[model samples]
Target: MIVEDSAVVRHLLAHLVSRDPRLELAAAVASAEEALAEIERVRPDVISMDIRLPGLDGLEATRRIMAEHPTPIVVIADAVEERGLRISMNALRAGALTVVEKPLGPGREGWEAVAEAICTQLFIMSQVPVIRQRGIGGMGAGPGRAASARAGVPPFSRPSMVGIAASTGGPPAIARVLGALPADFAAPILLVQHMGASFMEGFAAWLDGLVAPRVLIARDGMRPQPGQVHVAPGNRHLSLTPAGLLRVTDTPPVGGQRPAADVLFDSMARALGPRAMGILLTGMGEDGARGLVAINSAGGITLAEDETTAIVYGMPAAAVRLGGVSASLPLDGIGPRLLRAIGGTLEATGGQ
Candidate 1:
């Protein structure tokens, strides 16, 4: 299904979908109202949504659709406009699977390639199974149970930094995890979220306002302060040196992702060892699985979001299969478990 206001772009998107052998056009509508009217009737496997619409913008539309029908949605956003990018990020928070650069019509240069990429992304996203908002299930594991002799890790390990890897349904999950942390959470977070290059700047800016900690695009040679979050810049690998400074590298893409999660995790393993903590959240692939193993081998704490709460369990499942995780937890349990592994910081700071 396609929900777009522009007739020209809508027609082109429809054409793009029809032409792709891997995809099929379910419906095409000019407004969110039209989309809502048609969604239940058509029952599309996926939806291509426009962030900006005549009435009832994509963010609200996403929330309603996820609540009512629970279908996968991919937001197509204008990369040139900061506000559109912001709305796109908000749409992700509202339950859209992912956001992509809006394609101009075929008259524009490089339109064909961009359109192909968009279609491929749409098809790949369509395969992700969606569910009605369950509001963070499976909190069975708590801070008390975080320490496990069965998992082969110490009961307490003071981590100096945290590295996270996420993709597909990541934005909102990351938001929930970070928002659950206290004001003085005390770890510099290095995050690698798979997204289009154009969305990275706006993603960081939007996240900074939503979470207590400071969030910014990672920079080379920068030292991360406590409670600061550094997101890997687009098209670059974010790694840390043994000296404890961030490095944004131009090295070739690892596992087809420029700012691969493995790069960040591997670096953390080498630099911080037992003092490093890694979290593999909801995502569609195995990008961060090896990195988690690297950290586990170095005696660091590795946590993975269990399949029970993960939007998609690919990354976390991969880690579990590779023997990388010290504890497999639900989304609601991760923040508290991290705090627990810190040993005494939360009690000292008067935090829950």
Candidate 2:
């Protein structure tokens, strides 16, 4: 279903959806109310949600939809508008799968890429299974706990940094894990989330609002402090200097990811060695699998989100197959388990 107030954009989106052989337009409505009303009847496998809508904005509509009838929703948002971007991120927090920049029109520059990304995200996200969530900012929907342990592997005594990577269903998953941390979390964190360059700042802003750590776009030469998160800037690979300061570089995209999780994990392997903790979360590809192995080779702690909780099990499963992970855990268990690891109390969970 397509929900938008502008008739032009609505028609444009409808055209885009109709032209794609992989997608079928269930319904096109001018308001979220109409979407809510017709959802059960039309029963789209996926929905392209407009963040700016006439009455019942996309955020609230997403919350209600997830609560009542669970379905994968991809948010279509204006990339540059502050209010619109905030709403877009909040819509993700409300259980929308991912956000894509909306195509203004065929004449607009870069309109082709935006349009393609929308259809692509829709097609890919539709395959993901989403469940009914209660209330807004849906939290604690973990599918219980599962852990894998390798025996005789000793835990770390003092970790200096945390590295995390995610793609696909990353935004909300990142929010859930980061929000669970205490304000005084002992280590600084480095995050690499695969998203469009235009949305990075707003993504960081939204993360800062939800997480205990103070989140900021990573900057070159800046030192990360405890209880803080440094997210790789768009189109830049984030790493750490031997001096423990941040390094944002434009050398080249590793495996086609500028802010590749591999870059961060590899840097941690070099800079912090055994004191680094590397986590690979839900993503569409294998960008972080080798990097997690690099950390494992350095004797650092490594974790991958288990299949029980990952929206897309690609990245984590890749790491597991490559023998890089030390533990595989459910979404809800990551925070407490990580805390225990940092607190020097966690036992081995085999993934080796």
Backbone-clash count (model 2): 5
In order, what lDDT does every prediction score?
0.85, 0.85
Itemize residue pairs with steric clashes in candidate 2: 148-349, 148-350, 149-349, 149-350, 150-350
lDDT value, candidate 2, whole model: 0.85
lDDT of 1 by residue, 1-352 (tens): 9999999889989999989899988899999999999998999999999999988999889888988999989999988798898889888877798988888877788788779878988898889898885433323443323333243345545787899889988988898788776656667889999988888999999889888878999999999876778999988999999999999998999988889999999999999988889999999889999999999998898989878777789999899899998888777777766666654244564444
Q: Model 2, 322: alpha-carbon shift in Å?
A: 1.1
User: lDDT of model 2 at residue 301?
Assistant: 91
Q: Give the TM-score of candidate 2.
A: 0.90
Ten contiguous residues with the weakest lDDT in model 2: 343-352
TM-score of each: 0.92, 0.90
Off by over 4 Å in 2: 134-154, 344-352
